[model samples]
Target: MKHSICSFVICLLVCTGSLASAQQANPKYDKKLADSLKADAYGMKMYYLVILKTGANTTENKTTTDSLFKGHMQNIGQLAKQGKLVVAGPMKKNDKNYRGIFILNSASMEEAAALLNTDPAIRHKLLDVEIYGWYGSAALPMYLPYHEKVEKNQ
Candidate 1:
Protein backbone atom coordinates (compact mmCIF):
# COMPACT_ATOMS: atom_id res chain seq x y z
CA MET A 1 0.00 0.00 0.00
CA LYS A 2 2.83 2.45 0.90
CA HIS A 3 4.70 1.71 -2.33
CA SER A 4 1.56 2.24 -4.42
CA ILE A 5 0.84 5.65 -2.80
CA CYS A 6 4.42 6.81 -3.41
CA SER A 7 4.27 5.77 -7.11
CA PHE A 8 0.93 7.56 -7.62
CA VAL A 9 2.26 10.85 -6.19
CA ILE A 10 5.37 10.65 -8.47
CA CYS A 11 3.17 9.99 -11.53
CA LEU A 12 0.91 12.95 -10.75
CA LEU A 13 3.91 15.27 -10.37
CA VAL A 14 5.34 14.15 -13.71
CA CYS A 15 2.03 14.68 -15.51
CA THR A 16 1.57 18.16 -14.01
CA GLY A 17 5.11 19.18 -14.99
CA SER A 18 4.55 18.00 -18.57
CA LEU A 19 1.30 19.92 -18.81
CA ALA A 20 2.91 23.12 -17.60
CA SER A 21 5.76 22.72 -20.09
CA ALA A 22 3.24 22.10 -22.89
CA GLN A 23 1.30 25.26 -22.06
CA GLN A 24 4.47 27.34 -22.19
CA ALA A 25 5.57 25.79 -25.49
CA ASN A 26 2.17 26.35 -27.06
CA PRO A 27 2.18 30.13 -26.43
CA LYS A 28 5.50 30.56 -28.28
CA TYR A 29 4.31 28.64 -31.33
CA ASP A 30 0.86 30.23 -31.12
CA LYS A 31 2.31 33.74 -31.20
CA LYS A 32 4.39 32.95 -34.25
CA LEU A 33 1.40 31.44 -36.04
CA ALA A 34 -0.85 34.35 -35.15
CA ASP A 35 1.65 36.88 -36.49
CA SER A 36 1.96 35.01 -39.78
CA LEU A 37 -1.79 34.84 -40.16
CA LYS A 38 -2.13 38.58 -39.60
CA ALA A 39 0.55 39.28 -42.22
CA ASP A 40 -1.28 37.18 -44.78
CA ALA A 41 -4.67 38.79 -44.12
CA TYR A 42 -3.63 42.45 -44.01
CA GLY A 43 -0.39 42.60 -45.96
CA MET A 44 -1.72 44.81 -48.74
CA LYS A 45 -1.69 48.55 -48.08
CA MET A 46 -4.16 50.94 -49.75
CA TYR A 47 -3.95 54.48 -51.15
CA TYR A 48 -6.36 57.37 -51.70
CA LEU A 49 -6.51 60.69 -53.50
CA VAL A 50 -8.08 63.41 -51.36
CA ILE A 51 -9.70 65.97 -53.65
CA LEU A 52 -10.13 69.31 -51.89
CA LYS A 53 -12.59 71.49 -53.72
CA THR A 54 -11.93 75.15 -53.07
CA GLY A 55 -14.93 77.36 -52.47
CA ALA A 56 -15.31 80.12 -55.02
CA ASN A 57 -14.92 83.85 -54.43
CA THR A 58 -15.73 84.67 -50.84
CA THR A 59 -12.98 86.52 -48.95
CA GLU A 60 -13.76 84.67 -45.74
CA ASN A 61 -13.74 81.32 -47.56
CA LYS A 62 -10.40 82.00 -49.19
CA THR A 63 -8.91 83.08 -45.91
CA THR A 64 -10.22 79.95 -44.25
CA THR A 65 -8.76 77.84 -47.02
CA ASP A 66 -5.37 79.40 -46.60
CA SER A 67 -5.37 78.90 -42.86
CA LEU A 68 -6.56 75.30 -43.17
CA PHE A 69 -3.93 74.47 -45.74
CA LYS A 70 -1.19 75.69 -43.44
CA GLY A 71 -2.57 73.78 -40.48
CA HIS A 72 -3.00 70.61 -42.55
CA MET A 73 0.57 70.76 -43.77
CA GLN A 74 1.78 70.91 -40.18
CA ASN A 75 -0.56 68.11 -39.07
CA ILE A 76 0.63 65.98 -41.99
CA GLY A 77 4.16 65.90 -40.64
CA GLN A 78 2.86 64.69 -37.31
CA LEU A 79 0.72 62.05 -39.01
CA ALA A 80 3.73 60.76 -40.93
CA LYS A 81 5.72 60.45 -37.73
CA GLN A 82 2.90 58.40 -36.22
CA GLY A 83 2.84 56.14 -39.31
CA LYS A 84 -0.66 57.28 -40.20
CA LEU A 85 0.16 59.28 -43.31
CA VAL A 86 2.31 57.46 -45.84
CA VAL A 87 2.73 60.19 -48.45
CA ALA A 88 1.03 63.53 -49.16
CA GLY A 89 1.50 66.59 -51.34
CA PRO A 90 -0.65 69.43 -52.68
CA MET A 91 -2.13 69.23 -56.15
CA LYS A 92 -0.29 71.21 -58.79
CA LYS A 93 -1.58 73.63 -61.42
CA ASN A 94 -5.22 73.74 -60.44
CA ASP A 95 -6.98 75.66 -57.70
CA LYS A 96 -9.70 73.05 -57.44
CA ASN A 97 -8.16 69.59 -57.57
CA TYR A 98 -6.96 66.74 -55.40
CA ARG A 99 -5.03 68.43 -52.67
CA GLY A 100 -3.20 65.37 -51.41
CA ILE A 101 -2.88 61.60 -51.49
CA PHE A 102 -2.69 59.35 -48.45
CA ILE A 103 -1.47 55.79 -48.43
CA LEU A 104 -2.41 53.75 -45.39
CA ASN A 105 -3.14 50.30 -44.07
CA SER A 106 -6.74 49.47 -43.35
CA ALA A 107 -8.88 46.39 -42.97
CA SER A 108 -11.65 47.61 -45.27
CA MET A 109 -13.01 50.50 -47.32
CA GLU A 110 -15.14 51.66 -44.41
CA GLU A 111 -12.11 51.79 -42.17
CA ALA A 112 -10.23 53.85 -44.76
CA ALA A 113 -13.13 56.26 -45.12
CA ALA A 114 -13.42 56.62 -41.38
CA LEU A 115 -9.76 57.55 -41.13
CA LEU A 116 -10.15 60.21 -43.83
CA ASN A 117 -13.27 61.64 -42.24
CA THR A 118 -11.27 62.36 -39.09
CA ASP A 119 -8.78 64.61 -40.87
CA PRO A 120 -8.94 68.25 -39.72
CA ALA A 121 -8.97 69.42 -43.34
CA ILE A 122 -12.12 67.46 -43.97
CA ARG A 123 -13.79 68.46 -40.74
CA HIS A 124 -13.36 72.23 -41.14
CA LYS A 125 -14.91 72.19 -44.65
CA LEU A 126 -12.44 74.82 -45.77
CA LEU A 127 -11.91 72.30 -48.54
CA ASP A 128 -14.42 69.71 -49.65
CA VAL A 129 -12.33 66.56 -49.69
CA GLU A 130 -13.27 63.35 -51.45
CA ILE A 131 -11.53 60.10 -50.66
CA TYR A 132 -11.16 57.90 -53.71
CA GLY A 133 -9.96 54.33 -53.36
CA TRP A 134 -6.86 53.55 -55.40
CA TYR A 135 -6.14 50.08 -56.74
CA GLY A 136 -2.91 49.57 -58.67
CA SER A 137 0.30 47.57 -59.13
CA ALA A 138 1.99 49.44 -56.31
CA ALA A 139 -0.54 48.34 -53.73
CA LEU A 140 -1.22 44.76 -54.79
CA PRO A 141 1.36 42.02 -55.09
CA MET A 142 -0.82 40.09 -57.59
CA TYR A 143 -1.05 43.02 -60.00
CA LEU A 144 2.16 42.42 -61.90
CA PRO A 145 1.38 38.85 -62.92
CA TYR A 146 -2.11 39.91 -64.04
CA HIS A 147 -0.72 42.87 -65.96
CA GLU A 148 1.89 40.68 -67.61
CA LYS A 149 -0.78 38.32 -68.85
CA VAL A 150 -2.79 41.21 -70.28
CA GLU A 151 0.27 42.62 -72.04
CA LYS A 152 1.16 39.22 -73.47
CA ASN A 153 -2.35 38.80 -74.83
CA GLN A 154 -2.21 42.22 -76.40
Candidate 2:
Protein backbone atom coordinates (compact mmCIF):
# COMPACT_ATOMS: atom_id res chain seq x y z
CA MET A 1 0.00 0.00 0.00
CA LYS A 2 2.82 2.40 0.86
CA HIS A 3 4.64 1.69 -2.42
CA SER A 4 1.46 2.31 -4.43
CA ILE A 5 0.82 5.60 -2.57
CA CYS A 6 4.38 6.81 -3.28
CA SER A 7 4.02 5.95 -7.00
CA PHE A 8 0.76 7.91 -7.21
CA VAL A 9 2.35 10.96 -5.56
CA ILE A 10 5.31 10.85 -7.91
CA CYS A 11 3.00 10.66 -10.95
CA LEU A 12 0.99 13.65 -9.73
CA LEU A 13 4.12 15.74 -9.22
CA VAL A 14 5.43 14.87 -12.69
CA CYS A 15 2.13 15.88 -14.34
CA THR A 16 2.05 19.16 -12.41
CA GLY A 17 5.61 19.94 -13.44
CA SER A 18 4.84 19.27 -17.08
CA LEU A 19 1.80 21.54 -16.94
CA ALA A 20 3.85 24.41 -15.47
CA SER A 21 6.54 24.05 -18.11
CA ALA A 22 4.01 24.06 -20.95
CA GLN A 23 2.41 27.23 -19.61
CA GLN A 24 5.73 29.06 -19.40
CA ALA A 25 6.81 27.93 -22.86
CA ASN A 26 4.07 29.88 -24.60
CA PRO A 27 5.47 33.30 -25.41
CA LYS A 28 3.91 36.14 -27.43
CA TYR A 29 5.25 35.91 -30.97
CA ASP A 30 5.87 39.07 -32.97
CA LYS A 31 5.41 38.14 -36.62
CA LYS A 32 6.10 41.66 -37.90
CA LEU A 33 9.47 41.97 -36.22
CA ALA A 34 10.42 38.46 -37.29
CA ASP A 35 9.53 39.22 -40.91
CA SER A 36 11.44 42.51 -40.85
CA LEU A 37 14.55 40.80 -39.57
CA LYS A 38 14.18 38.00 -42.16
CA ALA A 39 14.22 35.43 -39.37
CA ASP A 40 13.49 31.82 -40.15
CA ALA A 41 11.31 29.55 -38.03
CA TYR A 42 14.23 29.27 -35.63
CA GLY A 43 14.96 33.02 -35.74
CA MET A 44 18.18 32.56 -37.63
CA LYS A 45 19.73 33.66 -40.95
CA MET A 46 22.92 33.36 -42.98
CA TYR A 47 25.83 35.79 -42.83
CA TYR A 48 29.51 36.01 -43.77
CA LEU A 49 32.00 35.54 -40.96
CA VAL A 50 35.41 37.07 -41.58
CA ILE A 51 38.33 36.15 -39.36
CA LEU A 52 41.20 38.62 -39.38
CA LYS A 53 44.73 37.38 -38.97
CA THR A 54 48.16 38.97 -38.63
CA GLY A 55 49.43 39.72 -42.10
CA ALA A 56 52.94 39.31 -43.50
CA ASN A 57 53.40 43.07 -43.70
CA THR A 58 55.96 43.82 -41.00
CA THR A 59 56.85 47.21 -42.37
CA GLU A 60 58.60 49.46 -39.82
CA ASN A 61 56.85 52.56 -41.13
CA LYS A 62 54.59 53.54 -38.26
CA THR A 63 53.03 56.40 -40.21
CA THR A 64 51.99 54.18 -43.08
CA THR A 65 50.58 51.54 -40.73
CA ASP A 66 48.63 54.17 -38.81
CA SER A 67 47.15 55.58 -42.00
CA LEU A 68 46.08 52.16 -43.17
CA PHE A 69 44.41 51.32 -39.85
CA LYS A 70 42.68 54.68 -39.79
CA GLY A 71 41.21 53.89 -43.15
CA HIS A 72 40.26 50.48 -41.86
CA MET A 73 38.27 51.92 -38.96
CA GLN A 74 36.59 54.40 -41.28
CA ASN A 75 35.59 51.60 -43.61
CA ILE A 76 34.18 49.65 -40.71
CA GLY A 77 32.06 52.60 -39.63
CA GLN A 78 30.83 53.17 -43.16
CA LEU A 79 29.80 49.55 -43.63
CA ALA A 80 28.06 49.47 -40.27
CA LYS A 81 26.11 52.61 -41.16
CA GLN A 82 25.06 50.93 -44.39
CA GLY A 83 23.93 47.84 -42.47
CA LYS A 84 26.45 45.64 -44.27
CA LEU A 85 28.82 44.88 -41.42
CA VAL A 86 26.80 43.41 -38.59
CA VAL A 87 29.57 42.88 -36.01
CA ALA A 88 33.34 43.62 -35.73
CA GLY A 89 35.90 43.51 -32.97
CA PRO A 90 39.49 42.68 -32.17
CA MET A 91 40.71 39.64 -30.31
CA LYS A 92 42.88 39.54 -27.25
CA LYS A 93 46.50 38.38 -27.56
CA ASN A 94 46.56 34.76 -28.64
CA ASP A 95 48.97 32.15 -30.00
CA LYS A 96 46.91 31.31 -33.11
CA ASN A 97 47.79 34.70 -34.76
CA TYR A 98 44.18 35.83 -34.87
CA ARG A 99 43.74 39.61 -35.07
CA GLY A 100 40.00 40.23 -35.14
CA ILE A 101 36.62 39.20 -36.58
CA PHE A 102 33.88 40.70 -38.68
CA ILE A 103 30.33 39.44 -39.19
CA LEU A 104 29.09 40.78 -42.52
CA ASN A 105 25.57 40.74 -43.85
CA SER A 106 26.67 40.03 -47.40
CA ALA A 107 24.74 37.91 -49.86
CA SER A 108 27.76 36.15 -51.37
CA MET A 109 31.45 35.54 -50.84
CA GLU A 110 32.24 37.87 -53.76
CA GLU A 111 30.29 40.71 -52.25
CA ALA A 112 31.98 40.23 -48.88
CA ALA A 113 35.39 40.18 -50.52
CA ALA A 114 34.61 43.39 -52.33
CA LEU A 115 33.58 45.04 -49.09
CA LEU A 116 36.79 43.94 -47.36
CA ASN A 117 38.83 45.35 -50.22
CA THR A 118 37.46 48.78 -49.40
CA ASP A 119 39.50 48.72 -46.17
CA PRO A 120 42.99 50.03 -46.80
CA ALA A 121 44.51 47.80 -44.13
CA ILE A 122 43.07 44.71 -45.83
CA ARG A 123 43.86 45.92 -49.35
CA HIS A 124 47.43 46.75 -48.40
CA LYS A 125 47.83 43.32 -46.74
CA LEU A 126 48.31 44.75 -43.26
CA LEU A 127 45.56 42.36 -42.15
CA ASP A 128 44.78 39.05 -43.86
CA VAL A 129 41.27 37.56 -43.66
CA GLU A 130 39.43 34.25 -43.94
CA ILE A 131 35.71 34.39 -44.64
CA TYR A 132 33.09 31.68 -44.12
CA GLY A 133 29.33 31.41 -44.44
CA TRP A 134 27.78 31.58 -40.95
CA TYR A 135 24.33 30.83 -39.69
CA GLY A 136 23.37 33.16 -36.79
CA SER A 137 20.50 34.98 -35.21
CA ALA A 138 18.74 37.30 -37.65
CA ALA A 139 18.46 40.01 -35.01
CA LEU A 140 22.23 40.38 -34.72
CA PRO A 141 22.09 43.65 -36.69
CA MET A 142 19.82 45.23 -34.12
CA TYR A 143 22.59 45.35 -31.52
CA LEU A 144 24.41 48.18 -33.30
CA PRO A 145 21.92 50.78 -32.20
CA TYR A 146 22.20 49.69 -28.60
CA HIS A 147 25.98 49.60 -28.84
CA GLU A 148 26.06 53.18 -30.02
CA LYS A 149 24.04 54.28 -27.03
CA VAL A 150 26.39 52.53 -24.61
CA GLU A 151 29.54 53.90 -26.23
CA LYS A 152 30.53 56.95 -24.18
CA ASN A 153 33.32 58.19 -26.44
CA GLN A 154 31.33 58.11 -29.64
Best-performing candidate as measured by lDDT: 2
Off by over 4 Å in 2: 1-27
lDDT of 2 by residue, 23-85 (tens): 543276678998988888788998999999998888739999999999999999999999999
> What are the TM-scores, per candidate, against the unseen true structure?
0.47, 0.79
Q: Candidate 1: global Cα-lDDT? A: 0.57
Model 1, position 109: C-alpha lDDT score: 68
Local distance difference test, candidate 2: 0.92
Error of 2 at 102 (Å): 0.5
Residue 124 error, candidate 1, Å:
1.9
**Model 1 agreement with the true structure over 31-126: per-residue lDDT tens digits:** 454453333333333455455665343345666767766777777666655545555556676645555556644446677667666665666765
Worst 10 residues of 1 by lDDT: 136-145
Q: What is the lDDT of residue 2 in candidate 1?
A: 100
Q: State the displacement of the C-alpha of residue 90, model 2, in Å, after optimal TM-score superposition.
A: 0.7
True lDDT of residue 139, candidate 2? 90
**All models: lDDT?**
0.57, 0.92
